[model samples]
Target: MSKIDFLVIESDAARAESVVAALQFLGYHPQRGEECLVAEESTHAWRAVYVGGVADAAEAERQFALLGAAAAQVPLLAAADSPWAARLGAAGSPFAQRMATIAFPLRYEALAEAMRGLYARLLGSRRGELRFVGESAPMARVNALIRQVAPFDSSVLVLGESGTGKEMVARTIHECSPRRDKPFVAINCGAIPAELLESELFGHEKGAFTGAISARKGRFELAEGGTLFLDEIGDMSLPMQVKLLRVLQERVFERVGGTRSQRCDVRIIAATHRNLEQAIAEGRFREDLYYRLSVFPLELPALRERLDDLPVLIDEFNQRLARRGLSCVRFGASALQALAGYPWPGNVRELSNLVERLAILYPQGEVRAADLPEKYRGQPQPEETRGAALLAMMDARAPAAAVAPAPAPAHDATLLPEGGIDLKDHLADIEVGLIRQALDATGGVVAHAAKLLRMQRTTLVEKLRKYGMQGSLAA
Candidate 1:
């Protein structure tokens, strides 16, 4: 009885405009940004769906198959032009209908007629809700990988840039794996000091070291029958690598001060921003260890590379932030456009911090260019380090007759005085907004959401803690 949110993925502009309008007219809440968008702002379940701008018939069928595999129980549709007809039309009286050929301008009347028929069938379908959002390619891959790897126990290596969501990848794998019911232990291989890491991975007996006043169960032992995540594994020292390798090969390790070996069945999920191959070549990391950990490698894409997912990411961020009582956090079109142009070198973590800062400083509402950092306001991208002459040449020349319009009036500084806000506080607010936004955009699809906001999921998480908004923004 209620309206369903339809994710309309179009390959080109023509299909996007027409399909979205038709969906709207059919009483559906449609999300029409990024063509590669995977899910909605908060979930993986898909309601009624449609695809536009498909290159050809074969491609249309392939796309539909993919949707069927990923969307749980939702109906999928594609635009039907007159030449192609509705080749994949559903038969009988169906509540939801998929239109493979969408109506376009060539023969407006014919297209409209086809769309109306499809809409009528769609409205009769029973399926109504879905979850998991964002449209990033890496996310789709990750989703597929989760389904495949979760049922088995394979060492997973998550490799990516900083703020790219490696930990989230590890978590997703663990959640979907056979050990989902068991513990999911996470330890930062780089965060702990070299002296302590050895003992942390392999439990220490009483009086093992200065703090070993009592016997302790290390992470590996604690994660028995579950998963043990080693974040920033590339940072572990040579000696530690040897110790970890021994455990992986033999599946047994002795405590720091005890000679007795302990056997644990915990699966290892290691992640790092650095390249292990490079580290091995430099003699910093062991080749054998790298191979052992990287048997199933999943490389996450950076936020800059997946610009098509920005809108869904924003929606995902808003949903998570609302959970934390930051209900009014929102974004406007121009602001998002500004975000798309900026180079998010700091990645998703940087974006999360910026969002948190916005939630703290700006009112709960659409963020503007003025509210963003100076670096994003108009700063050149790292790739644009070349001369401005090239940029100028790329700009189209305006006709003399249509001379420029008058500039808008200057902004009044008194409304939110820059001088009054503490610089640290301001920065913190930005961080909070960015983190909150990233988490929400992916429907708590932490990794994809993190990429959308140009941050690593862990980095965003740390900022969430710093801004004291972690619990509030739980996925």
Candidate 2:
């Protein structure tokens, strides 16, 4: 996960410095002018170009033309008030139509926000081709470990909760290894019955067993010179574990009911969400087998632990659904916040399922917080306070006319003359401002912020979603 590299084409030195500083602060690496024009960075690049009104229109056109097709696909953010903005927006140019614009005067925070929005959009477009989408520190460390371990033929034990992408890691290892061209086979040891497990792992000769009318090749024989992934190895019976351990120790196994011993040239990658050490202590799994399988161990982080990566996961799922002919759906601001706050017990697989469901049900529509399933629409509360929280939420929804008004602002009554205002927008802005202030004051703790706002936690959570301010609370 290198920071996305952006090219700034501002001819004004001060403006260029400002843009570069803003991008740098937002975790992007910024390059300037001629240095960024290289085609290598353009071909396999996460390159975005920002055109902030170069002093000369000819220089601006030249810079824009140099990027070629990259400018049309990669994110292009221009200042709306720039001298050449209208020309860039002119008809018959696909690049201009696709470009996003920030209003001029270049307010630092505004510029940063615009860049952040653009970055997320760019990520959506690029996520389809990625084998994995996380850029979180946890995933980054996992990727580094994968690169380090892929070249070796030693056994690897992947440990993680179900749906945490353990098999995906194993596949990545195989793809990166020298054995990539050979067969990569997978078997779930727990999914098959104990009686059939041995026969499934090692082939039987013709007429070797009760149902063996023909010779059959098992997983190890099928995999040959490549990799074999044994998932849920922790659930394997002790008898089978002993036999598997023998194969690992001797690299050979006699097929069930067959006398001849066969050599295996396969590399092993085992995965289980169960605690094999506990199983070993209980005499359900062999210590020798555990030691042999865990020659190298890797742990995958749960989705909740890396909530920051949800956006990218959503993007990846969106792309997958689109390829299947489902209409694409986008998450509204509040929907994203709601998703970020959920404790994903089933991890990435669960997230993908939800995204797929949304794509099917609401195809092409923006998913708001209210549109999410009830379980995912709000943060889960503790059982003890659930009743009280529900009561408070019910109380907070009394009719507007029935509710008491707050005290007037503590200012001079005649300080200024006021005309009628759009009361709805004015009050909505005030509510959003106060909610943000309370969240910041509480150090991003939603419970404390809700208390500060004199509302039930659930009520406050609803308002946060209503005003698209859930991100301010940080769940």
Top-TM-score candidate index:
2
Would you give me the overall lDDT of model 2? 0.73
Distance (Å) between predicted and true CA of 170, model 1? Answer: 0.7
Query: Model 1 has how many clashing residue pairs?
Result: 62
Q: What number of clashing residue pairs does each candidate have, in the order they appear?
A: 62, 0
Give candidate 2 regions above 4 Å deviation: 1-130, 379-475
Give TM-scores for every candidate, taking all chains together and pairing residue i with residue i: 0.53, 0.56
Candidate 1 regions off by >4 Å? 1-133, 379-475
- For model 2 the TM-score comes to 0.56
Which candidate leads in lDDT?
A: 2
Model 1 root-mean-square deviation: 23.0
